[model samples]
Target: MRHKCRIAQLGLPADQRKALLRNLTTELIRHGQITISQARAKALRKEVERIITLAKDGSLASRRQALGYVYDKKLVHVLFAQAPERYGNRNGGYTRIIRTVNRRGDNAKMAVIELV
Candidate 1:
């Protein structure tokens, strides 16, 4: 039984999956939005939100944690600097995902994931 298995494997091995999510999260933080496959967007949403939440903490430990996950050190510094002001009043729901048309070649459902 696949009960309570909420995490999506996304057809990738564990290492690849983590790498994909980490890269997606970094780009989302850098660009504010990105268009990607729906399944990937869904999985990426969780990671992005978690990192933003850590940024909200604005603590040395939280910053270190985020730095560990994010690929770019400079980007992490920028994010930590801006996140408090940007997300200070808000709580959670830092990202929004909007469904878009399917890809032409693969017909995969696509969506735009953006920071809110």
Candidate 2:
């Protein structure tokens, strides 16, 4: 049984997966939207939501923590500065994934992940 093995390997080695996620997270935050595979979107949703949650706190430590995962310092600043105010009235569910057409070649499932 695959009990408690929660992390999605994403069919990549550990370092590569981490790098991919970090890049995706930065793009999502900077652009407020991204289109990718369904599996990647699902995995990224968890990460982005967690980062937004940290941003909601607006603490120094939280900012540092988010900075660690996110590559751009300016993006992290934007996240901590704007995200809290934007999402202050709400509880959670910062992002949404909308199903979209599959790729032409591989026919892979696709989705648009956007910040809500």
Candidate 3:
């Protein structure tokens, strides 16, 4: 029956999807860039944008919420504490997707997701 179900499965169950997004969010925030498939990059872009929108405020609640996903206090520190100042005045579109050559073996499309 699987009708009108539009949520992306991401080839993972709920808990695993949360964990996967959490880890991806952390690395993207910390390193400023990560490489992956187009589907994941798009999905992860949403999560990263959500957190960054919250970060623009620099409030305790936003910090806590970001921490809920980010997990690492240090990363949260850099995310909310520093990023706001750096990205202040900007009104969203905080990430970028740079396409790359296909992966050697699997021949999968590769993309570099980075924070702007």
Top candidate, metric lDDT: 1
The true-versus-predicted C-alpha distance at residue 21 of model 1, in Å, is 0.4
Q: Which runs of model 1 end up more than 4 angstroms from their true locations?
A: none
Instruction: Encode model 3's per-residue lDDT on 1-116: one tens digit a residue.
Output: 76998667789999999899989988898899999987789889989999999888899999899888897888888777777787897888999999999989999888999989
> What's the lDDT for all of these models?
0.95, 0.94, 0.88
Per-prediction count of colliding residue pairs? 0, 0, 0
- Please give, for residues 56-93, the per-residue lDDT of candidate 2 as tens digits: 99889999999999999999998888986799998888
Which model, 2 or 3, shows the larger lDDT? 2
TM-score of each: 0.97, 0.95, 0.91
Question: What's the TM for model 2?
Answer: 0.95
Tell me the tens digit of each residue's lDDT in model 1 across 88-115.
Answer: 9998999999999999999999999999
True-structure lDDT of candidate 3: 0.88
For model 3, the run of ten residues with the poorest summed lDDT: 77-86
